[model samples]
Target: MAELLAPASCPLCLGGDNRFYHQDKVRCYWHCAHCALVFADPGSHLAADAELAIYRQHENNPQDSRYRAFLNKLAAPLSQRLGTTGLTGLDFGCGPGPTLSLMLQEAGQQMAVFDPYFANEPEVLQQQYDFICCTEAIEHFYQPAKEWALWLTLLKAGGWLGLMTKLAPTQDEFARWHYKNDPTHVCFFSRETFLFLAERDGFTVEFIGNDVILLHKKALS
Candidate 1:
């Protein structure tokens, strides 16, 4: 069982270090002491085919008021920061429907959508954007450090990276947390984890909401 619980490293910080955090009959969790990220063992991740199947079942309709409202938690705050004008952004990991992209477009922002499974557009990844919105996606990252580096590279200097993911709970709250139950959610982050990344990556982190954060890329000197 030791071998089963041993994840090679913390996917978020690339530290070959972590302490056992939690476990159930199905999956085990780890806590990265360096970055304060709680992640599930890699062996617990779902197969690519199965993951895509689950994504395909999502009803992320842009017309759904409830869904739009959920996305507004990130969109509204990001829009306020960007203002109403010629804003260009990327909707990273936009799932199958790309509702967030539509919402931003309606608010007069030119948005590009990309998802490894849905909108696999490599060219979009190659372009630099004024801002990037990654709603409901960060938790699904398998190699979070690599993905985060890519986001920093894709943004123009002084650009914004808006993300939406539920923060990890305290040790006492972990057992009852429902977010970890999702097989697709591998890496879980807390405010401390975000602050660590911000300090390391030269970003200015702001918690716009309980589940929303905005990381501003520092302008070059």
Candidate 2:
């Protein structure tokens, strides 16, 4: 039998250990005692190249109407909050084809794109931004702790961070969840998780959909 690793702690809080989560032969999710995020065991995951290949199969086109509409659900509201000033934004994990950055650019926000598998430009990571969006991307992070810290540091004071990912419903449903079936998706977040993350990261969180969340830095003024 595979010996279980030490009790997992909430990656967001690092204070509370997971005690209420479950697991199986293929994967296990643990409820974060501090932040409430139920994530997969890092030891059990796919390789980077293999994961990228899975993502590459996605037909992501900048001009896809339905895709644009789905993104607008988050973009429209975030855009409204920004007012008329053209702010710079970063689209983290833009994937093989970046559509959200295009949409934001069309909305008058100057956008920069970055993707580990697609647009892996080193310079894009050097500049800070007024805002950042990570649609359907956070779930793939192998280093959630490091990546999140870097993301927070990259945002200018009072900037917005938008994220979209399907929230986990129940542990039972998680067993059959098609979203988890995707080899690239490993990290999972719940509303409690987002709230915990926001508070810990010094931002405020708003839920837009089962899969959409907006986190804003505390107002400086």
- TM-score per candidate, chains pooled: 0.96, 0.90
- lDDT tens digits by residue: candidate 2, 1-221: 55566444555556557664666667766676677677777677888888877887999888889988888887888888777658999999988889999998988889999887889897988988999999998888865787788887889889999888898778778777788766677778888888877877789888876877888898667
Candidate 1 has what TM-score? 0.96
lDDT per model vs. reference:
0.90, 0.81
Per-residue lDDT of 75-122 in model 1, one digit per residue for the tens?
999999887667889999999889999998999999999999999989
Q: After superposition, how far is residue 218 of candidate 2 from its true place, in Å?
A: 1.3
**What's model 1's lDDT at 58?**
91
- Residue 67's lDDT within candidate 1 is 97
Model 1 stretches with alpha carbons more than 4 Å out: 1-5
User: Which pairs of residues have clashing backbones in candidate 1?
Assistant: none
